[model samples]
Target: MNVTETKRKVEINDLYKLSTAYDAQLSPDGKSAVYVVRKINEETAQYVSNLYVVDLETKEERQWTFGEHLHQTPTFSPDGAMLAFVSNRTKTNQIYLLPVNGGEAKQLTFFHKGASNPIWSPDGNMLLCSAGVKSGETIHTKEEQNEKKELQPLVVDRLIYKADGRGFIKDTYSQIALIHIDSGESVQLTQGDHSYAASCWSPDGTAVVYSANLSDDPDAVFTSDLYVYNIDSKETVNLTTGQGSFGRASWSPDGSYLAFLGSQEENQTVTTTKIWLYDFSAQKMHCITQEWDVDVEDVGVGDLHSWRRNPGLIWTADSEGFYFLMSDQGNVGVYHGTVEGELTPVLFENLHVYDLSVHSNGQQAVVGISTPTLPGELYTLNLTSGDREQITHLHDTFLDDVVLAGAESFTIKASDGWDLQCWLMKPAGYEEGEKYPLILEIHGGPHMMYGNTFVHEFQTLTASGYGVLYINPRGSKGYGQVFADAVRGDYGGKDYQDLMDAVDYVIREYDFVDEMRLGVTGGSYGGFMTNWIVGQTDRFKAAVTQRSISNWISFYGVSDIGYFFTEREIKSDLYDNIEALWKHSPLRLADKVNTPLLILHGELDYRCPIEQGEQLFNALKRKGKETRFIRFPEATHDLSRSGDPKLRLDRLTYIRDWFHQYV
Candidate 1:
């Protein structure tokens, strides 16, 4: 018998035992690779990450750093002698240098606001990093900022004044700076009211290419332009005409071309992101993936993976082609693309490739992948021979002792004749003829796709005798642009029918599913759908809506992304179409809800603020509907994914208990 058969099912606290490996980086010489592994410290209820290096030739792994703090963004020097990374070991994030041979790591930056995204210069004598600084404030030590602690009222004037995880936006802007590695001396590069990101030094180390919005009214404009900043002359030149949002600029190996991923639609959120290349010699820019209908970024949604960075475009030695990640048909995979618009599959599979790094020759690559059974691990891929090998066994032993339900993928036509990809996970100990409770899970980001990735919550639900069902509905990504943008302006219309059709198909096809004991739960956009579903039909016995929006009229003014997202999604503003917004709101149909609904929300979630949940709860209470509200204090929109460890466990417990009681 299999060891998993003798072992136990997955528990809620099993989250603490899981480990995630991401941010894989290949050495310059391609002999070895380094990555970061993160795990939860149960005592502190926080995540601690450490750097690890593995020899490609010997297949031996060694731990490079040890601590309770985060050590991420590990990049090797030009000559592959030392590694530069960002760490918060001193209570503030700063740049640190470690020698590959052997020695104590050295601290490099002392900016008061903290520094991140460390990039080594080509000559290895300097490092380019980013830190926050007020327009008129000079660089100061951390001690100076600690001395001032006066409470002041925040004054807001910009249109984009706040964010979800981050609170009120201050006057500080993220600026780029150059730090000399030997003396630790720093010089501010680009400084103004605007912010810069995805900055990298030119091959010759004389200039930098970065993404920023330098328009007059940056708050109102949604365009991100690429600019080149010269170090010696202190002059800036605009690369892109500022028609769209672009970033992740990467220079080719020969420094003749620049490749990046972006969308040309100014403020539209559903436009497909494509790869664009800039020719330095010709001073021209063109889209490389114009014919391809896939999004050039990872859109897979999962709770366990945290801090997964996008490895934009890794160039080959020839500078004529590069490798990139694309989301298509419910999976994110690596694809090879050339400047002439030829795209080939490099490692396309039914998995999530979250991070990637390629060798100088481009024949080998290190990819971070995750599946339904595996949380996350690093794998080495041979580009030429198409051979793949798992280099890290982080969860092998843990998985051997746990019975994880495998997902079965299928395609079904929606009510509107659209093909929808769906997955079903049977209960852990499902018998052939035994009827099991079914739970339909919805994903957030109405545009984000749910693929064959590991979700701890789904596993726990299946372990508790509930069959889990999930689908990438009409509004989800990984499909073409039309499918992703279809749900816009019609939230509860066709999208609602698509979800209902999925439930109907599953119940009719699978005799083991208990249709009468059905449950539905989703967060954000999924939360909205759950509320809408319960209000529309009484088929579901229990429903849980998390960080949901009930009233679009109020959501427009309350949520951080409410004003723009409402206009873009609902295609209506308060002044023009109040009735349309109200028609789509779940609270408008509160009197029709009969399901035992549980509302969960994060108090500090600005994206879908807590007020949205309170409004629904009050509406349901006024109508005497079966509803209960639970609020997590000090938690943000990221509560389900990267929140406090204890809170995450409590959340999973609450979800499981609610379903067990009602379903």
Candidate 2:
């Protein structure tokens, strides 16, 4: 037998062995590249990340930092003599600098609220950083208050006070600061109740551009504006009007243009994000990708690559064009565009490009890619010739002895004749005539597309003798604007039909999929659909709802983004249109559910609060239905993807065991 026939199947513990490389940064001369490698510590049940550097000429790699804590975002200085990164080894994340020659890394900043997102200055003498500071506070303020052992009541004054990962908000605001490399002194540049994120520095180092919402009541408005802060004059100029959301600003080499990514429509969640250019001489802004139908951002969803960073927009050295990642047709790839509204594909492929770093010459770039069988790796691409060379072997050894199932892509017509993209993964070591159970996987973001990326969850299920089916229904990105907005008012209308059509198509075409042993599961919006599916039909033998929404009335107040997200996505509000909200809620039809459901939720998930799971479980129990509830403590909405390692494994085990019992 061949080596592939003798390989072992993937297991739940394989998550600890997978290493992901991200946040790639190329040096000024393009001789060396630095990226981050992240892996889980099986003993500690926590994540550990370190910096690694690879030489382009020799293709030799070496670890740059070693620690049990997290280290990320490695940026090279202008001279390429030193590297700056962020680490939490000192109890809080702070900037640290290391000389390329050799020595111990030195701490650069001591902000009490912590500092991150380091941007090197043009002259290489200073670093632009971001830190959280409360009102009337400076960057040098030291922590003096003792740790509280008792709980204190929180005072809420803003609609956007609480967040999913960060929990209850303190009055802290993220502000920009400057740190002197030699003197180790820090100066706060921006202040107020508002927060600011520094994007880039001008070529001459005279001004810096940042994004912030400066409205009197920022909670009421969802627009962000870019401003240029002049260093010597201490003056600020608003480059963008307060009508749209814009960020990720990149200055041209010639210093005559500024490029950014954003949408002109404020508070519209379904609108496509476009690329815009600001002309310095003309003092006007124009949309470059307005005619392009694709979304100018990476929107591919997967479980393996968490904390993946986007390169945003990288400018050419000649200031003639730029490079960016765009999502289209269930794939994210690199595209080149010029200042004169010219666009072309450079490296469009069947893989997801999650991170990118362009060389100063603009002819080469380093990208982090993930596919159906590959978790993640870094590759150097020749921008002109479209040639790729793998530079990282983080997963080569581990994958050699494993058998992974590849996804088969196809298109199916929905009931309304809308073409939808879908993928199916058969069980590993499958036979032609044998039947296997099938599981339908739904992605969150109802706005995010499920593309060609490695998902550990899907691999584990397939390894356990189950087929997996995933589809990009209406209201998902990578399609046009209208398709993405189709399910706004009609939550369970066409989107539901499209999903059902996909399942029917797979079962009819592939006789190996057992129609009687079907299962369904999803999180967030997908979770809501799982609940809806069980209530609408008894076809599915088992169902799993994760971080789901059952009642829109309570969700509108409890969820972090519920207040506005409900109004935008549901097209209704708690005060004016209570009936419309109730009409689309899955809890309204909870009495009709017949499938055995397993509800999973995080205790600290403020995005889709735990109450959503509680209400669904309670309703199903009152009806004397078959159901179970599993709650994870200290976990957020991303429990399946980025939660604690042990908890993530336990979740997968529970999901597999539940399906094994019922399906």
Candidate 3:
């Protein structure tokens, strides 16, 4: 099938359609546009995501690829004649090139492993991509051979053990690669056990800058250095030699400056998140957005009515300033930052913003917005008045035909008086004095936040006779750097308290919450919190921990980001306090857990690793406590959002079943 047809067959599972969004983009000339479409197939147990092109002038939309594959990372060529994207149509994800007008999509690279994050070269003839190596290829191949031959006598000795949904695994390692669009050849530009991840082409297209941690530390995961690779020499020169984790790098249009956001020092969890601009010629680093001492990321909600997430940062027409995301004053808004370091806020309010695109003219920007009462929709925003106009009517058909539950946003002070913000989704037919079963849904990203965006799980939970509560706990971002770091070195301390406090406030304030029949669920850090919560308190009758960290010691060596993340979050290395890591580990306290728990893990999860669940389940079983672990054989860390559609649905079903059995 062609590109447009591929997009047309994009069907989404009704249960969790809003888990992610298709972000639209405008071209340099603003004559045409690009957007992403996502679908989930339950029968196939897969997610179908692809890119589509539309001619704004002609009002035409077309797909770019076809077949049982996932396509993403679509970028426009400088001349706007070709589109570059990464696809797994060949079984392993790799870069593919296609014409914007339409034609047979050309396969650019053939790697035994998968590739991701494709960016067009300045000249548009070559595409830069990130390459990942299967952690234990030789052993894995042998496992496949043994399984096919009907033998089961392989040795099971490895530091990195079995992946829950996947088979025995070690880890995922990735470096940067450059694919030649015309020749269909690729070259590994960076090398080492220290993986180089993020990829971005310099504005001038002379160098490709990325984040890598080619560290001497054997288990170092977060020690990434900013480096520029010369395509001609196949050489990489390290830029930021300092010790810090750099994320999401973007170069200023002038190429003289490169920018990325990161914490400033080593072993610092609450370091101020600053936009650092490095001078290519001066070899110096200067910090931007100095006014606020808080951390910033995917910040700012432009409007609730539009649709999108992770609003893209666009440069002004003159390149004098950059327009991107910032959340301050308890709101998310677009802010324009000048070259000299003056930060100006453009849009603000209690809206969740994502997938932002700026018109070539620079006077206006378009974003996806969602409010408390609506599903996400696309909208065009006048950067000047904050006046926004709705664009596509995506879900009005389904929404108008069904009775939808409403979400209410409120803030309550924690025990320490730190203002904690939360979103409560009451059951559709919620009645006064009716005590409804409550599901305390926690978010991950110990650095992320709860927002006004529509969450399918929350709505579904509310529809299923449960009240859902999600809060931006202490470690959550948007509350300033201090509060975000407040949970550092004290993982289950204040963050747990904050979550429990919210539960208490909800039970006291809302008569609909059946506190005695409470259920808790979370992924990643939230998963870790759930595990910790069950260990510390039995308030929750049922608990589901998705891709959680049960033991920090095992986690530090097994997970893709475990090494640095462990130290970064715990404020110490594994040896620094192996006992502390264990003490802080939810598994260590598992003997105290009596809550009926459901452990949901992805077979391919690398972030928290599946052994987390293994350890927890084994402990619970030894204790003869009620617990069950369900492993999604082909899912990843994002089982709820990016995992197999069937598995995603099954995940909800399993949680509901487990809760139903216990609650």
Candidate 4:
């Protein structure tokens, strides 16, 4: 068979062939750009990331780094002569400098605990990064020496001791470290029990600003304040005074103003992120987007696994205006804001901008965008004229050969009269009047919205001859704060009705849906809804729930954020409102569920512990309800997204086969 003539449906393994691009950083002159590209190596069953550079004028893209190194966080030096990035080829992640003109990369620092987040000073001679150090050890001591000690028992003394991906909390604190590019010498800048969350340098390079929560009970406070550290005097100045959960500080070009993103805890877990500015001359702080009514930062949803953090503020050369990505109405757009609190749309459209970098001149930008049909790619946009040109085509050949379904967006009224945004994607290669099975997909964060972004899981279901239906129900972001906050106290109330109404609208409008063969699935918050839906109704023929929460009473003290999350979302307490907590728990209603459900969970998931899944499974099995449980070993709560590559493919296969047999 000829290569182009052979047409095959998207298999579970095709995920390895797809590559993701993100985190674009433009050079000083605006003629070149560097970004991160990630692809799976099937032979090793690991994902590898490397830096790629492109000529903005000619639109030529080429890989800059090679070999087994997993390169990321690429940033150009202040003089644009060298590019610094973090790689893990030496068993631990460390910063490496690569000449812009093309030469062998040189490793900069060899810290004991590794290094990350390299920030260039104004002079480009010294670099600033953070590393974790032990309580009684300096940066020169080897962490491996302590690891070789006789198996000593771990003694826990703090309220927060363990994390999901990082395991148990050891006696290590992340302190800022300064490295000289010329001498390759590393010096510890700050020391204490607390860790610096993030940092940036001033224009003069004499002071470094960072955010940290230095309270006595840091874990219980849920607050971080900005602090400035002087290089010569080694003195520190508190900036924000521990007012809010603030970080991601950016310095203005003239060193007169500092900007950061944060929000006051109005609804706690449902608070919206906004931008705040601090003035050096007036020594005052103010909220710049207090009236914008939009969530600042990229909360866009996509099926691909992404580890890219939010970028710093893209300040203009004149330091009068800045650009950022904010979540709004089913899409993330880049917006421009003035230092005086004026906001305007710079690149508003139906798309998801994961990360971006603006030119120093503020005339153009390199953005990482993903839409419904595009997996992910890079584009250069003219800030002045609003013109966009594609820069990378990583999956062009594969996409052209395969037939895919496009999402059709629509709006409907919820049971409570609120407008709801929903989408339906027909099965690939659908014929007129041909009925197909349907799957209703829900997103993880009940706070996260399903919008104009590429969803690989949904596409896999579509390729398997199923129509996919998704909706931005109440409690989903992209709507106003009121709508997103409505589902806090009401878990299965209006939000449940909104999902059912979405299904009804689709069945009434589209005649190609097989109403009897309906399937449903979701993860995290969506998983809770799936558990709730199965208990409330027997309409869904089959269902799959991943990383779900079943019992709130036990969950209060078990999960990582269970203590505060229960207080905020469920509005209940273990000591005071045990009955109320049980009332909202899905395990309480497990006896009512008759739908065939396949419980998928990660054994190492601390957010919604594996015990939650076990409890639900045992409840259903004891009641003679059809249920099966499958657990992925050594996987975290993000198993579906960032887990082992082989395990992810197996999960897709399991999902497809379960629906195929039951639906």
TM for every model, in the order presented, reads 0.98, 0.99, 0.83, 0.97
Q: Number of the top candidate by TM-score?
A: 2
Q: Write the per-residue lDDT of candidate 1 for residues 1-663, one digit (tens) a residue.
A: 966679899999999888889998999989899999999998888999999999988889999999899998998999999999999998889999999999999999888788999888889999988888876774553445457698889888887888889787688888888888888899988777888884677878888888998899985788899988888999999899886988998888788998988989832989989999999999999998887888999999999886898888888889889999899988999999998999999888888888899987989999988889888889899999879899999998788889999999999998878899999999999899999999999999999999989999999999999999999998899998889999999998999898999999999999999998999999999999999999999999999999898999999998888888999999999999899999999989999999999999999999999999999999999999888999999999989999888988988888888888999
Clashing pairs in 1: none
In model 1, which regions exceed 4 Å deviation?
Answer: 1-4, 140-148
Model 2 alpha-carbon drift over 4 Å, by segment: 145-150
TM-score-best of 2 and 3: 2
Q: Is candidate 1 or candidate 3 better by lDDT?
A: 1
* Candidate 1 similarity to native, TM-score: 0.98
Using lDDT, rank the candidates from best to worst. Answer: 2, 1, 4, 3
Give me the candidate number with maximum lDDT.
2
- What are the RMSDs of all candidates, in order? 1.3, 1.0, 6.4, 1.9
Superposed by TM-score, candidate 3 places the C-alpha of residue 294 at a distance from the truth, in angstroms, of 3.6
Native-to-model Cα distance after best TM-score fit, residue 186 in candidate 2, in Å: 1.1
TM-score ranking, best first: 2, 1, 4, 3
Clashes of each: 0, 0, 25, 0
Q: What does the lDDT come to for candidate 2? A: 0.93
Error of 4 at 65 (Å): 1.3
Worst 10 residues of 4 by lDDT: 1-10
Winner on TM-score (1 vs 2): 2
